[model samples]
Target: MTLETGAPENGPIMLDHDFFRDPHPVYREIKKNGNKPTEVILKTGMAYIPPGLKAWLVTSYEDIESVLRDPRFAKSIADAMPLFAANAPARQEGGGPGRSSLLYDNMANNDPPKHTRLRKPLNGIFTSRAVAPKRADIERAAAETLDAVAAAHRGRDGFDLVQDFAFPFSIAVICDTLGVPVQDRAAFNSWVQTITGAAGPEELARDAGRMAAYLRDLLRAKRTGTEDDVLSLLARSLDEDEAVAQAYALLAAGYETTANLIVTGFLTLEADPQQKRRLWSDPALVPGAVEEMLRHQSPFNLSLYRYVTETTVLNGVELPAGAIVFLAFAAANRDDRRFARPDEFAIEEPRREHLAFGGGIHNCIGKHLARLEAEVAFGMLIQRCPELSVLAPPAADAWKVSPTFRGLRNLRVGPVPGISETGRAHD
Candidate 1:
């Protein structure tokens, strides 16, 4: 297998460089054997692992979508990895808190009843209409972020879009939606950074607990009397534990995914300047372009850990009860069977079915919000900095390594010659 920094990964899938930087090639190799969504038992000497990465890796569009929609394909990370779940530090090392503090709380990775209960209260807020009013706000946030980047690089030619624009732009929208206290916003980034795979397990556990406590306290404060923000609405109904869960989900899900999308959208367009020109020429294509970006450049490589609820069969692959399976989102999006010229970037595809935000009941609740943010972000970006061009491929040496999430460490874009007149790039 080709790797980004180190020697080639000729073994099983671990956190290999080749897989992260341009995973399409690796994904094609997985399908080369013509046994997509193949069944295999991960063993030592074959797979190069960094620690507790043990699961049934699922690829192929049909199988991935099937698994995602299948009720038997469970999302219980605890039952799937019981040993790791019991060991808190090891679990944290693997990926933050386990069953007790996380699985039950995070609706994105849990099964029904509990999942239903957790997701019920805040569903209304994420719907398209509910999020419609925030379009102007998101646009403003994008513009403001671009403004800061412009100011910083006034004399200079370039800046890091991930640090200067993508992250800040996303965080701004989240802060507004959550009504995160002005004072709390500063500390908020520190807390989010800890969870973003920057801190070690011990630090992660401590930070997660601290952040949970902070959110719980914030919920309690809002419970007295509050407005229509999600937290305020949740505060009225949910207990501290429940409120903390919802708040954490909202905060984590809201910004990170959109931030990556923002970075990828710009980077992808930059890679293919002609496509960027087409998009810039046709403003109506912005929404469809966002869909294509989601399909082609999925931010999260795989879905959260899923356990087999019962005996299941997919394309002759027998999965025993309680077996672990990771639904491959990025791979499925590029499946040749599902997409025409699957690897190529097409702004306007005739058929585009992407699992970037997942599907079925456990699908991303904030997908509409994420889409809106991207629509405004790219639209504003093309308008705000027309001279913007990539210095190099936006791929980075350091990546946020998480089993569930994938994001660039930094994306350095150059040739930005200050903020341009909004209408100057009419070409």
Candidate 2:
């Protein structure tokens, strides 16, 4: 379905199911309008904003980067809450606010110096240098997860990659990094799903509060515990609420996005068998391949809503004060101006700046760790499970329902001839 460029007479363009499953074509259509911003609305429950609310969708690399870097575009959730409150559709019974306070309180949703202050303690920890030491742990976790997947489905038709491998594996690593107890780890999947899913206000509130309480308890435990995880570090430095909020952001950010990256990365390889073969032939290309995966199919379709603090011109378009803007990273990464043959997934393509992890001060802090994890994930899959392939064509409802995030609901694979519990192909 073609995306209409101008403002619709009825309302903002309603994003259809096709748009969620495959957004590149829609993005291409939007970018065709001389790279101008278009007003659009996400499907109900698919966005952090109220569904059917009109928002500016910035499609071009130049415009998105400009918005990300410009202080005129505020990142604070408080700035955007009034807009949601005014424009939000009537909530169901017992639904007070559209979003929980826990979501709005974090560094990701705040402008500096609040954003600066909150991110300061985290800056040193997530850098490439600091994250390098965790490579061994990431690899071990990936291998173990793969082993379980192979063993469970050795003779079965197929097994879900997301449920059996990617989601659990990614959550395990993040939980370990955060020092969440093994018993408490199981609750995270349910908590994160409700918080991020297209759930009602009460469900969102309940999950957010539960996760917040869990983080608070974990932080309290870390005060006297001997663990050296991220939570322990935050426990010593920040107060209870501040630390819990940051921890919540970390958990939310580090969990689904990374898991989706792994699943999508494999999907990219499956689509381009030559690329998969190239990686298997030469493991050295894994890192660059991971970057290409990020660019070709970024895990996030758009950046979080940035409110216009004052009237400003972005990409020759005037956006009034309090206007809501969403930077379409998936769209910008596919802009032909920035990367030649942007639609194709090619590892050998020359390096270029892509907005996959976003840009500017509010950019993703866990980017280095994310890249490292993807590299390990792709490398291990190629080196060990060379015979692996997607079992059948992905189902019509394969993609997750979130408007902002892109990930598979489940990916089936296997019915291996000779796969061992070790996850190695035994011919």
Candidate 3:
């Protein structure tokens, strides 16, 4: 159903269910229709202008950037309760505190002064100065995981990259950084899987409560004991309730996105051998490669929903106060106006601004860490596993299922001849 538009219509559009499932086609369609700023209102009442929110999908890069950085647009999901209620399912029992983390909840979710206060402590912890010491540990863990994968293959033909390499590598690094016990890693992995799965709102709520309780117990233990981990640091720095929020935020922010990056990076490299070869030859290129990967395969396609605190005009489209906006970072990253050859993946593309980590006060706090991890992980993988190739037949069907994160559920890899079992450089 199309919205009644008093404004002039400039293009043809289709409202199809597939649009939600795979929006690239729809985006292509929108782009093919020309550059005129027209609107396609969805049956769900979300408008797609071009590259913005699904509901109000703004197509223009400038418009999306404007809305993203604008103070008038509310960053908190709570602010858009009515809009979410209309589109998303109702909340389930035991959903616990809705806003959980300083990054995801009160601070990142809130606007202006409150956000600033909430983020200050976290900003201190995640800055380059603070996180620098952890780099060696991160690299070591990634190397060890790759070593294990190499060992497991043991001159074998193939192994699942996601399971054997990427998943373990990312999980181990995050668990180590957070100081979560190695013994508890399995349980935490299970919890994260349940929490992130395609469950109903009620299921998610229940999972959130369980996870929160688990974190609370961990925080209590850290406070009472003599340990020096992130949890302990947080316990010392924050109040009990705030500690819970921090723990929850770390779990939510750290795992899913990193896992996606690992899987997507591998897959993208496998698809483009030349690019992979270039990266393998020059390890220093990993940093730039990570940025290109982020631009090419944005893990968080949908923007965290924001509410309009005051009336705003996004790309000349007047949005009333209380309007819910989903800043489509995935779409904006591919905006032809801002990006040359927006559809193609070019690692050397001039370092133009991309919203992969988002923008404004609510940008990802773990951005540096995420980039570092991906760069190290992928850089090592290509260099160490020279014979790595897709085990599955080359077909689009080989891709995995996940709406929020785009990555392989199972990416099989074949080892190169002469590579050692421990992923060490072989003669």
> What tens digits encode model 1's per-residue C-alpha lDDT throughout 178-258?
888667775777777666553555566667777877887788888986466778887887777777877887887788889
For all candidates in order, the CA lDDT equals 0.70, 0.78, 0.65
lDDT of 3 by residue, 21-93 (tens): 4557766765665432344443321111112122445555777777767778776544555555553344335
Give me the overall lDDT of model 3. Answer: 0.65
TM-score against truth, every candidate: 0.86, 0.92, 0.82
TM-score between model 1 and native: 0.86
Q: Is candidate 2 or 3 superior in lDDT?
A: 2
Q: Which lDDT value does model 2 have at 318?
A: 70
Q: How many clashing pairs does model 2 include?
A: 0
Q: Rate residue 422 of model 2 by lDDT.
A: 53
* Candidate 2 residue lDDT tens string, 160-183: 878988888888888887788778
Winner of 2 and 3 under TM-score = 2
